[model samples]
Target: MGITYRRILLKLSGEALMGDLSYGIDPAVVNGIAEEVSEIAATGVQIAIVVGGGNIFRGVKGAAAGMDRATADYIGMIATVMNAMTLQDALEHLGVPTRVQTAIAMQEVAEPYIRRRAIRHLEKGRVVIFGAGSGNPFFTTDTTAALRAAEISADVLFKATKVDGVYDADPAHNPNARRFQSLTYSHVLTHDLKVMDSTAIALCKDNNIPIVVFDLSVTGNVRRAVMGESIGTIVGGLCEVC
Candidate 1:
């Protein structure tokens, strides 16, 4: 089956991997995500993933606790590398070709990130997982996703989250909060929406890349989003349709 998007960058939070656990990855949840990704790849969509490390360790949180900010961030980047390896193993177990590339050179475990190689992997129908953020401190994984999406020339950025879509307010707290089917990049930035970090949002905006915020917990939502179904909030030029 052909997908609406030929290529996409998927950004998943470390918290999403946590599932019901307080910290660390939940195998079942990770496996479910891997299966979903495999299904999407089978449909011929090139997928590149960037997994965050907030579940295992948050750099900002660590820095707040008096740790050297750069050191804390570096540790956080390593945490993401761990998540990437686990995800790569799961994807391979499902018989899907996957590669883990890290910004920091940990040649013993994963390949050092190279833009051309990553694009080649996607072109060859392999899932490429980008780890270790931008190899720089003070950069969030969201920014890494946006930067990679722009570099890889992805058609869209899929932000897999617990919530179905972007809302005017915290949907969990305000029962009456309104959910937006679509939103403009300016609107997101102007309102300072937490949909993504400012740097990430600005990067996507500058590159003219659309973003889809969808609930990854839903079994078929990934496929739905890839096929351009109206399942979640869309940010960018396409919001005019909403």
Candidate 2:
């Protein structure tokens, strides 16, 4: 059978691009992700990616250190542009037609974010990468991903993370942390699961978009998630308990 979702938005955390490094992008990791994306695209799935900037810089952390919140968030936004460019290069190297659309204007390096143009690119089988985190301060990339998924009318939002799925506790700190197979958006917001920011979750809940939180570190997990193979915790668009 074919894949379940025809179109998807993949939310990649910036920290996942770090690989084994303490900071900055790792070429190998970026290339691996590109490879996976390429494979899925070849199977006729339209993919759009929204990358975070937490590995290079975090707005909240900067704000905690007394930097002006707006300036710090702008810096974080630029970091995501850097990541978008890197991923674009990697995808192009694999012969996958890709485009980088930045929320913040950077005419030379990438196109400005235009919803209809992005949808056109996806229809043409070109992967679109969204950068710059909504072109607004005090907004997380998680929210950007949610907003883009809604705009693009993606069937699912694939949240690629380090953990296999959402847990009752931080899995690294709690060995016995229970991995949830599925959850409702209310459950996430109520428990403060940290799977995503509450605003992002609420957006998905309201838009009726499903989210699959899976481990990107696992070699084939991205493909699995896109194929609806039940490799991770799913949230939203469900009324039954799991």
Clashes of each: 0, 0
TM-score of each: 0.97, 0.97
- lDDT for 227 in candidate 1 is 90
Q: Measured by TM-score, how close is model 2 to the native structure?
A: 0.97
lDDT of 1 by residue, 1-242 (tens): 44789999999999999999999999999999999999999988899999999999999999999999999999999999999999999999999999999999999999999999999999999999999999999999999999999999999999999999999899999999988888989889888878999999999999999999999999999999999999889998545423
Q: Show pairs that collide, candidate 2.
A: none
lDDT of 2 by residue, 1-242 (tens): 45899999999999999999999999999999999999999999999999999889999999999999999999999999999999999999999999999988999999999999999999999999999999999989999999999999999999999889888888899899888888999988987889889999999999999999999999988888877798879997463443
* Candidate 2 segments exceeding 4 Å error: 237-242
Query: Which candidate number has the best lDDT?
Result: 1
Return the lDDT, model 2, position 162.
Answer: 88
Q: Against the hidden true structure, what lDDT does model 1 obtain?
A: 0.94
